[model samples]
Target: MNPVVEQMNRRRSVRNFSGKPVDEVHLGRILLAAQQAPTSINGQQISLVVTRNKETIARIAEIAGGQPQVAGAEVFVTVVIDYHRTREALKSVGAEQVIAQSAEGLMVGATDAGIMLNALQTAAESFGYGTTAIGGIRNDPQAMIELLGLPAETFPLVGTTIGVADDASLAQVKPRVPLATFAHMERYDAEAVRRGVAEYDRQLRLWWDEQGLTQMPSYSESTAQYYSRVYFPKVAESLESQGFEFRDD
Candidate 1:
């Protein structure tokens, strides 16, 4: 088996870290890894702002609803979905007029930003460093944009904090559903999907209970509750307030 494959299988989110710092050499390699990720249309719209400043880290932790692990990480990197670079690239090549008139370019920028983040996470894990992705950073987009000096149309999507893990900070790998549940044959099988979820829900509830967490409701119920209780409304408001016009044809 390939070393990278093994690493991929073992990857888990780490929200705790040691006092030790990540060396600059490894940090540069991680940036390189992000740059190497495949981008939509080669748009390469991701931008990263690295911060080692304690004050800035503190602010990010606060903005992320006070995730203490974030404040103590050795380095923080804010990943942004950026349109400024794309806009400038188009202008330099005399394509600005056409590109600016279409939202296609903007969509590509956002997709590439997501690709870059996954690359960064993989790179950090491969190098034996711990990382925690801070999605709540999006909750205070306006403040983060100002703090990071982001130009209009450029926005912080999320951030990742990285450091070596302390002995006591090691985390267990959480179990996911068996491949048979999601890896299906050629055509979609609705019944199989439904049955799979039933089995997985049992597995999940058992795991959660063992970990001293509350039992899950039925899979569909839990799925609906997650979005209704935590996701969609906030996301919709964020996009609208950030000036992203929703267009339905």
Candidate 2:
């Protein structure tokens, strides 16, 4: 396999860091990689805020559902989906309105943020750094917005913590669903998806058993329960309160 593919395959979330600091030059390169990530129609809708202040990191950790890694990592990068900058640009160019509050605009911004985050992660990994993405940043979107001093038309999408990982913190790579499960040729295949998920569940269960985690539920069941009971309700309310308009009409 190609070296890049091998490196990517080795990537896993690292929650326990060694607490050693990352060199500034390497951090600069990682940020540069994020800056070069592709965006929709050249609209750079993502902004990154690097927080190295210990006190601020601790506060962020509290806001992020008490993820200690946020405070203990060498650095925390908050990836924000920002239409505020674009809105200002439009105003400067004499455009009458900014349409960043709509669903389409939100999707574009979020996509840009995700792409940049991937770049950041890959770059950090290539530079011999361990990183983990923190989605808990959205657990309290309003608080995150106020804490980060984010302006209107900007939202925190995700966060990444960069540091050297402890030997014990390199978790085993978890199994992923087969490509056939999601990749289709021209049309969707419901049967393939069903079979694929069933196979994946079996594989996951085996892996969990080997790791002494037999209580873990199947991927499909867990995801369905989470979205239906926990994720959607909270996220929808948070997004709406942050000026995002979702229209399904």
Candidate 3:
């Protein structure tokens, strides 16, 4: 496998850090990778804020449902979907700004944010840094906006913590569903998914059993444990609170 793809394929959540700050020079390279990521319509509707402020990191951790990885992180990068710059440019030129009010617009920003995050993680890992994406940030979008001082047309997309990995926190990579389950060859493969579901559950249980975690639940059960309950209600409120309009029904 190619080195780049290998770096990307090693997807594990690093929840422990060494409490050491990252080198600004290396961080600059990661940020560059993020900036170079492709965005929809060349709009570049994204911005990232990097900080080492202990207090801010702690607050973000609290806001993210007490994620210790965030609380202990030496570097935290806040990625947001920012239409503010484009809005200002449009206003200055007396052009109508409407994309910020629809489902497609949000999709563009979120997709760009995701791409940028992948680039960030790959680049950071290349420098021997550990990283984890915090989806819990969506639980309190209002707090994120106020804490980050994000302007209208700017909304939190995701967060990342980068630091030296603690040896103990380095766990084995978790298994994922088979490639044929998701990556169809030029078409959707419903049958592949039907077959892969139980296979992945078994694979997950075997992995857990190897770790002496016999009581651990299967993939579908674990997934349902989270998905069965409604989560991130704040995310919906964010559409209105953050100056976004959602029209898709």
In candidate 2, position 143 carries an lDDT of 82
- Where model 3 places Cα greater than 4 Å from the true spot, the runs are none
Report the lDDT of model 1 for residue 64. 76
Model 3 residue 226 lDDT score: 90
- Of the two candidates 2 and 3, the one with more favorable lDDT, higher being better, is 3
Best by lDDT: 3
Per-candidate Cα RMSD to the true structure, in Å, reads 2.8, 2.0, 1.5
Question: TM-score of the candidate numbered 3?
Answer: 0.95
- Writing each residue's lDDT as its tens digit, candidate 1 over 1-249 gives 899998888887787787887989999999987888987767767889998998999998887778898898989889887667777887797874333224664566567767777788889888899887788787777777778888855678888888898768565676676676578778777787778887877887777677666754645577877676655235445554545543422
Q: How accurate is candidate 2 locally (lDDT)?
A: 0.84
Q: Each prediction's TM-score against the native? A: 0.86, 0.92, 0.95
Local accuracy of candidate 3 as per-residue lDDT tens digits, 1-249 = 998788777868799998777998999988887789899988889999887889999999999999998998888898899999889889898998889899988999889999988888888999989999988888898999999999998999799999888978587999889978978899898989989999999999999999888999999998898999878877878868878987664
Candidate that would win on TM-score: 3
Candidate models: Cα lDDT each: 0.76, 0.84, 0.89
Off by over 4 Å in 1: 97-106, 212-225, 230-243
Better of 2 and 3 by TM-score: 3
Q: Considering TM-score, where higher is better, how would the candidates rank from best to worst?
A: 3, 2, 1
Residue-level error in angstroms, candidate 2, position 181: 1.0
Candidate 2 lDDT, 82-150, residue by residue in tens: 877777778898984345656788778778888888999999999999999998888888888888898
